[model samples]
Target chain A: MHIIIVGCGRVGAQLAQILSSEGHNVVIVDKNQESFKRLGADFNGITITGVGFDPDILKRAGIERADALAAVTNGDNSNIMVSQIAKRIYNVPRVLTRIYDPLRADIYKKFGLNTIGTTTLVAHIFRSALLKESAKHEFTIGNDIGLVEYRVEEEETAAKESGGGKK
Target chain B: MYVLIVGGGKVGYSLARRLADEGFDASLVEKEERMAKRIAEDLEQVLVIAGDGCDPGRLEDAGIARAQVVAAVTGDDEDNLIICQLARDTFGVPRVIARVNNPSNEITFKKLGIDTVSSTTIISKLIEEEATIGDIFTLLALKRGKLSIVELIIGPKAPAADKMIKELRLPADSILATIVRESHIIFAKGETVLKPGDSIIALATTDSEMALREALLGKE
Candidate 1:
């Protein structure tokens, strides 16, 4: 699948490398050319140096034919604008954005755009790890339901599988 | 009316001060705490909120919920767009205006149904109008840059100076709308005779602006 990733930051570079290695066509855009270095010499992908929200830059990145777009720019507003342009203008099938502000992320989600608030998610993860909690909240679905992962010991799993779980 | 102005840059600062002076309730939100404090001290009538305008919480604190109009004049186009969207879509503000830092982003802003003012576009237009020869000035742009209403002065040595309107070879998609001679306005007609010093207001396709000017004032 043809994918366009805005911002060649750590996450964007990693995503690009993984997708390109998986044989998917990946094009990453960053305002600074220096950001492309994060992708490393072995990474195989196209790099565009321009603002992600710019239509001309997006067109040059082949947004019209992109199967998916990820806007992981450091600026939340820039990411939101790029995701909106990819989804509403180019009609890219899949679009995702990373917004650091949780409130803004929730508000943008109401606009029908997929957003991940790294600040909130990271905080949640840190809290769970620091507390050594068995259950970790991965993400919240809509306003209420939270999808959580519960860690179980190997013995507990084996016992449960044998229908001998502790009461 | 209560108006919320985002970004404490020069444009936003001056606009908020002017609006407050005009007896309107104006509130400004600036990301830079120092600048916001300076503006708060400078503008007695304007209320200043120090926070990121893109943040809905900051906007709400600046009275976005009751704002009749929201103007996002940030230097960053993306931030302005986000603030406008938050004001219009979330707060349901009746009017939202954004300042597009990059002139090319004007169309995108317009496409998203957001009113945009591009200083770059306006400044470039002024420079273009000033640099234009033959005393032709673009009065207004219409049809999304497709057409322009221009005011051209018929110079003493112009080709169409003393010619009849019907005999003048105007550029395609161009028509003389009216002529102001000696403070008298005359609606252009086929039989009307052109005269030197007459300021002709014509409607022409933007692409034909130069041709129209050359047709009236001759090649310069």
Candidate 2:
């Protein structure tokens, strides 16, 4: 599959590495040439240095034939614009964007755009960890279906066994 | 009409001031609190709100629901695009205008039915018009910049000076619309004779702009 990923940050680089190693044609774009270093030497994917939302740059990255496009730029607005251009303009099959603002992510979802907001997701994960709950809120499928991950550590099992008598 | 402007940069600030002075209800949203306060103090009529315009909540605070027009003139094209989308799609504003910092993004904005103003395109056109072809000025660009209506003043030594319109070798796509001699407007005809200092208005495609300029103003 031909994949185009905008932004070469940690997540972007990791995704590019995994996809590239899985034998997919990957092209990564970033505004700074230095960001490409995050992909390291083992990565075998094309790197483009230009604004992610610029049509010329995206075309240069072969967006016309891309099966999937991921917009992971730090700027939520940039990611949203790139995702829209890829999905609405180029009609890429799969267009995903990362938006830091939870409000913006929800708004774009209402517009029928695929967006992932890490701010809320990470906060949920941290909150669940801090509360030491076995059921960790991973994500929700929709309004009602919440997918929770259950963790059963040895220490948790021991604590439960010891507190069983007290209860 | 109520106008909501996002971004506190020079364009947004001055636009709000002008709109307020013109008796239109205008409010500006600036992300920087200090700049917003400064602009609020400077402009008594316009309302200034300090918050990121890309955030819908901030736009709501600026009263986007009842805004007749929304203008996003931020330096960042992405932010402007988002703001315009929010204004148009979410709030259903009658008109949404955005500043395209990168000229390449103008098509994207236009495709989404958002009006765009590119300072880069405008400034470059002005510089090129002033530096090389001082007499020929672009009155308006139409058809997505494919066609332009231009005005050119006939110089004393211009090739077309003292010659009839039919005699000049105008570009194939060029059409002379009118000739203004002094303050009187005359509809251009094949038999209309050109005179020095006459301002000629013509419609031509972007590709024919240089040829039309040369035909009227002579090569510089």
Candidate 3:
């Protein structure tokens, strides 16, 4: 798959490495040329130094033929704009973005865009901590559901095996 | 796949519950007998053991050798790290995911070669940001938040269908990730045509999502 990634920060760089390692055609774009240094010399992908929202830069990164686009820059606004263009303008089949603000995630969903907020996941963790006695690990799933992990004791496990029903 | 989670704390218990929900075999080992008993009462399917997570014997008892993944999410960072390493080296678990209480510990975890590290603080900050921002959705954090993959559905009247991918002119910070049509995944490419029913997936920053939606659905 051909993937275009905006932002050369930690998240962007990591994504690029993973995708590139998986044998996908990856192009990474960043405003600062020095950011490419983070990718390292062994990196095997096209690197473009320019603003993420620039038309020419995206073109150079091969957005026209991109199979997927990822906007994970530090700024929320930048990520949203880049994601919009990839989907609306280029008609790229897959578009994903990283949102730091949990509230914006809802708005993004209304517009039919998939979003991830780091804080929401953290909240789940905190909530789990707060309610450690009742539930276990808690993480946000998608919009409606949450993925939570709980532990089973020996007695509970036995009850389950015996069909003892919820205790 | 079976998984072993060390700690009966919130993170550990959460991991157990989630794995069970997904129909995966999971067990928990906690040092506190009371916590273990409580966990036992709460989760019916998970196997709860009262023992030290860092001990090889406890891990073996939890079936770590056969477990696909082991997650150490105790409140203590050092304990989590040690348990994670033991799971990886001594038990030979395929994957180890650890929870970092402090953000600073993340770098050390990375250096130690932990498979995955999640920071509750960072995640909370992001959630707070989302609650306040009002325009983005944070879907999932992968690889310590280095990469995120998200999903979006195209509106029936989206202008995106009218234009070829080469012409839509998307913003720079984002990329069209993939299209799911009737469960089939279509990788984005220049020649790929957008259909009204296509469920799109994308990766981008938080704010640009609106534009991505407009591009696919056309102006709200």
List candidate 2 segments past 4 Å from native: A120-167, B132-134, B152-170, B181-186, B191-199, B213-220
Q: Which stretches of candidate 3 lie over 4 Å from their true place?
A: A1-167, B17-24, B40-45, B117-122, B125-133, B136-170, B176-220
lDDT of 1 by residue, A1-167 (tens): 99999998999999999999999999999999999998999888899999999899999999999999999989999999998889898899889889998998989988888787888877866666566666645575333334454445633331111121122
- Number of colliding residue pairs in model 2: 0
The model with the greatest TM-score is 1
Docking class of 2: medium
Give TM-score values for chain A, per-prediction: 0.85, 0.85, 0.78
RMSD of each: 4.9, 6.2, 25.0
- For DockQ, the strongest prediction is 1
TM-score of candidate 3's A chain against the true A chain:
0.78
B55 in model 1: Cα distance from truth in Å? 0.9
TM-score-wise, the better of 1 and 3 is: 1
DockQ of 1: 0.72
Better of 2 and 3 by DockQ: 2
> Against the unseen true structure, what C-alpha lDDT does each candidate score?
0.88, 0.88, 0.74
